[model samples]
Target: MRYFLTLYILAIVTLIGVAGFRGDISRKPPIEVFPDMDRQMKLRPQEPNAVFGNERSSQPYVEGTIFRGMPYQDTPINTGRISGTTNWVETNPIELTVERMKRGQQRYNIHCLPCHGASGDGKGITSKYGMVAVANFHDARLVSMTDGEIFNTITHGKNLMGSYGANINIEDRWAVIGYVRALQRSRLATLDEVPEAMKAALEKE
Candidate 1:
């Protein structure tokens, strides 16, 4: 009984030592595990500093400069619309070459597969974890959407989706759209669309 009582007192002391003063205010500076980050010598925005000739911590963006790996124009490639018009383009402005399609596949696997799925069926891994309303490329509405409209969706995002324009470059954005079209076509394609060289083997089956 004595040993247990002593142990209980020690445990209470330890608990109080660790947590009793958590909410108390202290004047002394707290010990920092990483002092460099805790006291970083960095400029704060909108604050006056002597670093620049203007003595301003915040500076205006340089003229004629766009964000790196981004496009900010109304051209067909950037806007995914008819040049100088509000209408969406029916076709991708960039040529959908084999290389671009391959690149699309790669980029799609990285950025899209997590939510859009490998088949573009919107049944990606996230769906199992309660992510809802992922857009399925095979849907009729998406099938009928113009390539430019799809590009716009990727650039600006829609509904629950967020903008990928900052993340995906212009060329690659078009490439991802091209790859999505290919995925949609995959489910709708007929035997006639198959290559003559491989038609014999499929027909034999």
Candidate 2:
């Protein structure tokens, strides 16, 4: 019993010594101490500004420069006749034959009719809800336009129309122009101009 009592007293003294050491260390100042500096003298890296807001302080790029791979330049635009040779060769308008007209009609119906109406009357579904009005190809102004002019308009849209250059290829644009002319002709074609044989063939079909 005396031996066990001595062991307990030693254990109690060791725990008290450990606790006293911990308390002494806790009362002492921390090893790391930070000094408060003046706001102006503080060295802080500035953050990058957002791209959109505060335009006045933003940097501007040079104007009239052309980026590689783009067709257009930022230079002053001169709306004039296109100079130099073009793939658009001048040819007599295709004959208003049924087969040729049918091809044009098919192309127009698929790509154009939804926005320009089946009659080319500019009453297409998109036009009805669209902010800008679509042109009526049947109008005298458009009907009198040359085939090349019509083709250009289709390739690079005029006024409020967006360009179809990407959507429809050059050949298809010409075909659609031919079809527009055919539609105009159909609206104004006289009875005398309609051949007797064509009338008979159409009736049989």
Model number with the top lDDT: 1
Clashing pairs in 1: none
Instruction: Report the C-alpha lDDT of model 1 over 1-205, residue by residue, as the tens digit.
Output: 9999999999999987755677777676776889998888889999999989999999999998678858456788879888778999999899989999999999999989999999999999999999999999999999999999989888889999998988999899999999999999999999998999999999999
Query: What local lDDT does model 2 show for residue 204?
Result: 71
Model 2, C-alpha of 205: deviation from truth (Å): 22
Task: Report how far residue 81 has shifted in candidate 2, in Å.
Answer: 8.0
Q: Which prediction has the highest TM-score against the true structure?
A: 1
What local lDDT score does residue 96 receive in model 1, on the 0 to 100 scale?
A: 89
Q: Tens-digit lDDT track for model 2 on 32-106?
A: 434343224432334345543643334455696577666542211111124343433343244455675677778
Superposed by TM-score, candidate 1 places the C-alpha of residue 185 at a distance from the truth, in angstroms, of 1.8
Worst 10 residues of 2 by lDDT: 72-81
Off by over 4 Å in 2: 1-101, 196-205
After superposition, which runs of candidate 1 have C-alpha atoms over 4 Å from their true positions? Answer: 1-71
TM-score of 1: 0.66
- Residue clash pairs of candidate 2: none
